[model samples]
Target: MTAGHCSDSGPFNSDGSVSFFHLPWGGIVGRRLIGPMARPDMSVADMGFISKRNPDIGVIPSIRNTDDQEFPELIIYGTLDSDTVGSTVCKSGYTTHVTCGEILAFGVTVTFLNGMEFNGLIKATHMSCGGDSGAPVFQFAEDILPGIFITGMVTGGSEEQGVCVIEPIAKLITDDIYVLTINDPI
Candidate 1:
């Protein structure tokens, strides 16, 4: 689960191969997971996946929350019902770390300066940097569950305006690729 534009930028090889590192400086690497209709060379849908790298590295189903001393990493239970316009959402990226904001709108279509249009995007007021393309967009749900819900992934954003665009995770879930969750629904 990464933005298609991320592959267009970096983090992935030319053949759609990607490796996930456990730490920011790369401690443990994760296996390459395949995605559906991934834009390897383009950023049309802003969704992409990396091919197989090392199958030995272990991966976990969690979201980063450095502010929480009790629970540094939040477990990913599942997604909630449908997010509304006023729903509070947060994004986690290495550049910005974690920024929280409300959803402005959904089903948006943004066109970049290079004339590439990406549809099915959710617009939010959170901040993101250039290299934060594949960041995770999620919402913490303590009432329904103690963990966070993996909502979507960051695609593009306006650094000046302090806003970001995300693509819903539901669109990326296929028979093969999926988010590892307990209550995962197909």
Candidate 2:
């Protein structure tokens, strides 16, 4: 996928139906949404750009078949857990594109209809404000090209501590990683 920095500084739209600003790493190239999210109501308009400093947009499947069942790309984000106390995590959102903080120790495990369970942790602080639900998360890596593996979804952040919980990507999908196909892109 191609990407570029925000040319216009006004109202933003991330819905696939609408063309929004996506400044790729270092604002070198720009990309328009050629596909929609797995959920019809979701859109790239919901998420914003990845900062040049952070320099990663989660993960985009390197290869896959058209008939395969997987998401070509995945984004996940959430707030810090209140009980967590250690290394910090990063997040991108509409309000604040990049925010980082420690993870809280307390959280709840949610089970999906497929019997997949996600052990979500409350972030120690609010990395996201309003308009951040559905944001994406990435596991940071220094050498990897993508440098991140799309992990889960950001549900919400609390007002007091800014703790947000995440739904692990494994729990959301049937496969370990999304398989993408060039013949018929999703």
User: What C-alpha lDDT does candidate 2 achieve relative to the native structure?
Assistant: 0.41
lDDT (10s digit) by residue, model 1, range 1-186: 566555444455555454444345222454233333234545446666654344554457777767657767777886653469988887777776777878898889889876788787788885654567788778888785447887888887897877888877776666887787755442
**Candidate 1 weakest ten by summed lDDT:** 25-34
Predict model 1's lDDT versus the native: 0.68
CA-lDDT, candidates in order: 0.68, 0.41
Best by lDDT: 1
Residue-by-residue lDDT tens digits, candidate 2, 63-169: 21122245323222221222335646555554555555666554465343334344543344566644555555444443543234444456555666456665444
TM-score each candidate: 0.77, 0.43
Report the number of the highest-TM-score candidate: 1
